[model samples]
Target: MKKLLLAMGLSTFSMAASAAMVDFNTADADGNGAVTMEEAAAALPEVSPDAVAAADSNGDGVLTVAEYEALASQ
Candidate 1:
């Protein structure tokens, strides 16, 4: 019973962490389905442009939802 309680607690914590993710639409100011460096800055001032560049997995100078989620998850 104690082990089951511990597992439930861990799952709840994981869900809470995932729920705290940054909003992709708010970051994508242009509504273009991707976030440019400028938009990312506006949404996450602490995040550097270099970080955004690194998150641009497709070399498109922008971050897709998947890319942004990957960065935020880190």
Candidate 2:
């Protein structure tokens, strides 16, 4: 049915969107749970250190997965 096809299409789209999320491992080169400015720079050269600092929601001088995702989304 058309409805079933639409549901399958929507599910596929959702899966693709989730898959497009940033890969934390790529940014966390040292296998740390968080990313430092140096690691972020390696993965995202277009981003500035100041921007990474601003994205550090916890003021811990590093970025967790959530923080990194927020920066990537921007």
Candidate 3:
């Protein structure tokens, strides 16, 4: 699954089943301190908005590296 996700370049993920961890810096794409919705979508195109929101514990509208890490763990 990890290889598949890598090969597909951030396709939809089954979070509960996922082990294809997201690399924060790689996903950030712009070197920004946080990952915005656009950045998250760009990194994981088919990932659900609800999922992202769920991961954004702070509700700050952007995912800090820690937030992103939490998202990946989901």
Question: Which one wins by TM-score: 1 or 3?
Answer: 3
> Sort by TM-score, best first: what order?
3, 2, 1
Write the residue-wise lDDT of candidate 3 on 1-74 in tens digits.
75455546544433543432657876776687889987786676557888888888889999999888888766
lDDT of candidate 2 over 4-34, digit per residue (tens): 6544654565466642243676567678799
Error of 2 at 11 (Å): 31
Model 2 RMSD vs true structure: 11.1
**CA error at residue 6 for candidate 3, angstroms:** 11
- Model 1 local distance difference test score: 0.72
Give me the runs in candidate 1 sitting further than 4 Å from their true place: 1-20
lDDT values for all models: 0.72, 0.73, 0.73
Clashes of 3: 0
Residue 70 C-alpha lDDT in model 2: 90
Evaluated against the true structure, the overall lDDT of model 3 is 0.73
Off by over 4 Å in 3: 1-20
* TM-scores for all predictions: 0.67, 0.67, 0.68
Question: How many Å off is the CA of 34 in candidate 2?
Answer: 0.7
Candidate 3, residue 47: how far the Cα is off, in Å: 2.0
